[model samples]
Target chain A: MFDPEAIERIRAKQRAWEARELREFLARQPESRADCRTGSGLPVERVYTPADIAATSFDEIGLPGRYPFTRGPYPTMYRGRLWTMRQIAGYGTGSDTNQRFRYLIEQGQTGLSVDFDMPTLMGYDSDDPRSLGEVGREGVAVDTLDDVEALFDGIDLEHISVSMTINPTAWILLAMYVALAQARGNDLGRLSGTCQTDILKEYIAQKEWIFPIRPSLRLVRDMIVYCADHLARYNPINISGYHISEAGATSVQEVAFTMANAIAYVEEVTRAGVDVDRFAPRLAFYFVAQADFFEEVAKFRAARRIWAKLMKERFAAARPESMRLRFHCQTAALTLTKAQPMNNIVRTALQALSAVLGGAQSLHTNGLDEAYAIPSELAMKLALRTQQIIADETRVPNVVDPLGGSYYVEALTNRVEAEVGEILKKVDALGGTVKAIEEGFFQREIADSAFEFARRKASGAEPVIGVNKFVEPPEPNAVPVHKVDPEVEARQIGHLRAVRAKRDGTRVAALLDRLAREAADPGVNLMPVTIELVKARASLGEIVGRLRQVWGRYVETPVF
Target chain B: MPPIRVLIAKVGLDGHDRGAKVVARGLRDAGMDVVYTGLHRTPEEVVAAAVQEDVDVLGISLLSGAHMTLIPRVLELLRAADAGDMLLVIGGVIPDEDVPALLALGAADVVLQDTPPDAIARRVRELVAARQPR
Candidate 1:
């Protein structure tokens, strides 16, 4: 091995050379003050050297697949396997979405990610008056087991992993997924997939929450325990920063707040009498990959390191897998533009590359038309192709943690780790993430960051390619956006009504009542009851509304 | 008079709300009273909120590739209640292909997702200008 001092001296010389070059360049043309801040508004120095990370050691940072996995989670990394290719999908009725799912699988997508309609997301059935005109509009409308079965009609749960992006009714969706697998003769224990059962982000970022915070926490705890025991291979909750970033938080806030939410989940599950090592391994994360290339990459590296440390030190996790942070990344939808719609392909390609370089286990590249509408067939194909190009053509996956020893990247990773730590401390001081949410700390921080970001743009401090800079007049025909079937609502509602009529009404009612009673009892785990209700063909509205009755819905008191 | 109350509800499956939230903040900053119903708000809930809040305008945001089906029902609800005077504006990831139909369903105007915040605020003001007569 090379001498540590010798390596330090070489790095110092390179830093000096960079500083000298920067000085010579600045002497010719002054750099803008705004050019110095990272995308998240953190100040960037002209150069970083060994001094920047003097406190960090090789062991604390560690090698791939080792303790405190700052470099990479797996020893072989992409050499063994590349990140799973996933594209977010759902629209029209269950049949329509099922077709799309089949098409995606045919296109060689390695995994599945389910997107639900607005009515279904908010725990409403297509037959409800409130669901009028909304069914199957944005996502596949799943009101019952029939709809759920239709969604994955031919897809095998045993072979391909699936991720359901629902929170308020995550348990219902999980139950539906389990029932679908069982019907196909797959054992519940053998199913592999993840549910975005992260209620904190729903309340804080997405605002798709159904129950109050405390009860929601209990529900999440129940899923963790149930999944640990039965669906050992399945992930119950994928705590997400994707929505938070999409909602306008900076990269630092994205990682920080998401880590805070993850901590809350770990604490809740631990309190529920589940071992940390049992569920922590399956506790996946979802983050957004944005245009801030290096910082975005650094954020991923820091996230792994922080999670590993937290799991080992805070939770006392025994297994290395339990401490490892496996994540799925989606290119930032907010970065796409409607002006030059096709340009989003290039943007997504760059963001996806960053996530890979930072070692994401799975990725979804947003379509070029994401800024304008739900992705069309052509646009989504382009999105999948973007990932294909990177994986097959670019040879980026051939190396493991390729950016690991760079001075700039290491410094940035350390900086992000420190910044996220500070944010974690703030959340902790507020008596954990739940209390922080009640006190509106997370919301306030995000708003403040968003406000500052907007102020920067307005003041010409930061640049957005299509928005602030590179002004282009709107094109007459940029590209046509996708239009969901107009009759989808009526058709979906009809199906839902038919199913309600055909199902055993007495059994459905009894199961729903049992779910309500179980929900009321904090100690009672609602997983088995929820599974039975979904199996009994109870509507999404009935299940969610029962919880609403027992654990009154939460109303947001906007903190601004 | 109290600030012109406007309710922004997201109907259907559109989760692209950066535009909606930004518009809501812009309107709120512009001194308009805004009640953001958050994401995935059902038509019934949105209409009930509009009726109860006595909102002067109802703005619905949808981008889930589902506008054609969702927007018309919201308008029909208003028309059926004789609350059609409440200036209806639909925004968020709206395709130009469906703009005419949305406007035909009593939407005063359909705001595209890429429309600037200032333009959205200005359009809402124009729609409610006569209604907010002193």
Candidate 2:
């Protein structure tokens, strides 16, 4: 924020410079197009000056690590510590994925982000009738505690943080993780990892709902409370906008919708009698960093500012950590092109840089071949190299907020903050997130954006490098694809059967009955009971199915 | 010409229906009768739906690499049901190496991920026109 005297001088000088400098330039170059816009279709001005940021004040754009942290979340951001190079990975059976996890850790990846296959993600066991042909294709298949144990078999759970990209059955997977840690004698208080326990986003974009909205919110609240009490070093919930963006939301909607979901979570937890600062400090977010470098950077800055102000004023938070918005970001997988798959490497690197510049706390750079298959080992290594290149080679992370004082970035930050605020208000006005979700509000908005982007790409208004332009036919020299073994399904099913045959049937039945009873009651926290069942050797399907009997499966109305 | 009746379905446990829903809308925009069999459908349910809807074209979308295992099953069921003539088109996150195997399993075409909505519409029309009764 500049003083008024300097602002007046800068404004007058900018006008004169524009008049004299633009008169000569406009005659020759004139603007190439009638309008220039960001990915969200927000207008981009020809020039920005100090006058553009004249309205902001010092308090609004406070110093990094201070209240309403506009510049960056922490004062010495990357200087104090490097962003976690967490690569998202998983494939095949448990042992297979464990090797990949260990491989990444050896390649200097700081964190492990787990990806679950469709059956696991949908809250069903591998042997479920509906899970045919999809046991471990997209991600690793976890049917029971045995599978979870094998997935992290040799990998030390304490040394590295694990982030499971599972929802719908997030609570179950988390319970299994806690149980496994306890069985391994790791202190439950020191279990460090993130379970993407964001169920609201599932109903909104991902469409992996196992129960209706209210029950789903209850599960999220239960996890938040349980983690707050038990898992001090763990992040119980990661209110996410990554899937929302992948589902077709623009940057603004992604922020607003994600924040609105966060508010709902805050309300539920606080009303459950958990204090504001109790769980809010550990609350984390997941976002997709699209290709637009400046827009994406501005979105991150604006997100921190908006969240801080909202927490301090609305929820009456008592701590700075509770006010600060910490988040993890990934390069946009939706923007990856399958045409010339190699181009994705460059795209991913650029997006990763944008995230780094935007002050992301942790980041995942998508593999180049992700659009084709689960990233091959070679592709995953290259993805990790991209992060290393950005952090170690580029000198990009040397400063806290190098672009903080720029005219364009600051003005764009304010603009994005205002836009996100407007969308959040709309979500609240529609009787909050759950009411809006039932009405298909978020779904419709995202579908519209997805369609618009698709149409733009189809028409060449938006020229994707290899998709609609400079296209090439399928070549022989393709990225070596990783295929889930054809026998993985049968072997996984056999393993499940063996686990079932060996476990004490009576104890399993009793634990499941108790789980069902607890699930039926509205005043129960299902985490402790879910943990008990998981420890009792109850499978994912058994636990989920028991609750499913009590709270019926969710059948969503198709929005499109 | 009656609209080319199509059943757009997701078989297997792949929860990604964004592509399926978009293609369904695109086909509907092109004036085809599109019936979407929502998420978590089995191959048997998909086959039964195709037979019941009497769709001329059946577009099955899978992003989880289940096409290799699930496609043959759907094809086998259709043949047993005497509906082998139905056009079995596929799309979504498919690898080029598996395209031939899927085609050998009786797929009509592998629609590219970013194909235009009208191109899908046109292809469905052309496929039906070729199979029309004399």
Candidate 3:
């Protein structure tokens, strides 16, 4: 923010300097490329000056911990407490992932994030025919509370924050988590973690939906209300742009689509008579720290500013906490190359640096071998060490929003905010998120962007180190990938069958019937009933299947 | 002649369909007719769709590490249905060690992540051309 006179003088000097100094320099050494753009295809100028951010107001880029927190969410930020190094770890059975959890925690990780197998994520039992050959492969497979208990066996429920990367059956997992905590005599209010309960994103980009849009929103609302009332310290929903970005959305689309989904969720919860402030404070976000260093930083800043304004103006949220936009960022997995896999470590480091400078509250630095499979133990440790080095060795986080005053960053932040606003306007014009999703608006937009990126990479316009530019001979089996035990599926299914045999069959049936009945009534919150069912050892598939009878499954009209 | 018909299918629980969608668009842009069978389709469903669509190439994208189990099943179903003539291309985050196994199981080609869509399209064309009785 500069005075008009000063800005005018700066613009005049820039022109004069460009006419003489830049002309001579450019004549001697012409620019490399005529068209230079960021990863999102935004134009990047030769240089940024004070005139670039002249239009931005000082208050718009306010101090940390203040309203419209473009700088950072908290005042001290990393200076007060380093971001939670929550590396996601899940594979094989529950005990198998539990070992990884203990290993990561012992390796100085501050938080725990679980990655469920397809069965658990899609609300299928490990033994379901659809879950055939998929059990405990991609991530851990949990059939009931017994599996969840084994998953978090030695981990302290109160001290450690757990984030579950489950969407469709997120409510069931939340219910299982609550039941686990109750059985362990842990205080629900003191329990802390996040369930990625953002269902609209599931429909938009992730394509992991069980129920139709309306009923999915209902489940999200129930989780928000249930967590707000009971688990005060827990984050009920992590509105994610990570999956959106990974699914080929540009940086702007990632923010716009996720915020649109966030708005829909807020409306759903608030319309159900819950106050915005009650649950808004616990509303968290997840984003990807992509390759474009400054753009990723600017995107984070712009996202915070937009969200603050939206909460205060649109939703009428009163509390400052409700206005703050806190997020967990994982280094972009799509950017990692399988060719020279070691190069991904450098990419992840730079991306992690961008995330920290952008003021992410929690971070998950992806492993180098992620392009192949889930990271091995050594790779996960390397990823965690990347965060540690950034926090302890690098003094970049010593200052709050270190890039806040940079003209380029501020100008880019303004640009991203404007672009996101335009997209949101289009969504609103299309009758909001659900309506837009129904029309395949988000899907088409993301697919087009993805296609464009693929075309660019194919043509060598965007050079990926090991892929396009610096070509390398194929090295077969160079990187040792972590393989899930082949017997894991059989073991998980046997455990599931054992759990079913042990639990009371009559009570489980009764709970499922009641859950289905309550699910039919739109007024009833499904969390309590779902919790009762999970407590009764009703499997995830049974609960979701019964509810599917009432609220039919969602079948998306395929959009490429 | 007619445009190359390719059916890009995601035959598993993995929802990472960006690769599949990009490849589909690329194939379409490369003057091919591409049909995507959405997400969460089983091997049986995928084989049925491939047979019904009668496409020259069927590209199955799987990222859930279930490729070993799922791809073999798809190959089995294709043989059972006498649709083994269709070019079965496997794509996604498939490991290098498993590539030979997948190829041995009758997969025409195994495309890993970061293969440009056009390259994938070209590969599909080459595979289909080789399969043709010229």
**By TM-score, who's the top model here?**
3
DockQ-derived CAPRI band for the predicted complex in model 3:
high
Higher-ranked by TM-score: 2 or 3: 3
Give the lowest summed-lDDT range of ten residues in model 2 chain A.
A474-483
Residue lDDT tens for model 1, A401-482: 8988877888899899999999999888889999999988877777666655655665556666776778688786687677
* Candidate 3 pairs with clashing backbones: none
How many steric overlaps does candidate 2 have? Answer: 0
Query: What ranking of all candidate models by lDDT puts the best one first?
Result: 3, 2, 1
Best by DockQ: 3
> Per-residue lDDT tens digits of candidate 1, residues B55-74?
88898877655566667777
TM-score of model 2 vs. true structure? 0.97
CA deviation > 4 Å runs, candidate 1: A1-25, A32-35, A458-460, B1-17, B28-60, B64-89, B103-108, B119-134
Rank the models by DockQ, top first. 3, 2, 1
**Evaluation by DockQ, superior candidate among 2 and 3:** 3
In terms of lDDT, the poorest run of 10 residues in model 3 chain B is B125-134
lDDT of 3 by residue, A246-349 (tens): 89999999999999999999999899988999999999999999999999999999999999999999999999999999999999999998888899999999
Candidate 2's displacement at residue A448, Å, is 0.5
User: What is the lDDT for A17 in model 1?
Assistant: 76
CA lDDT scores, all candidates in order? 0.83, 0.88, 0.92
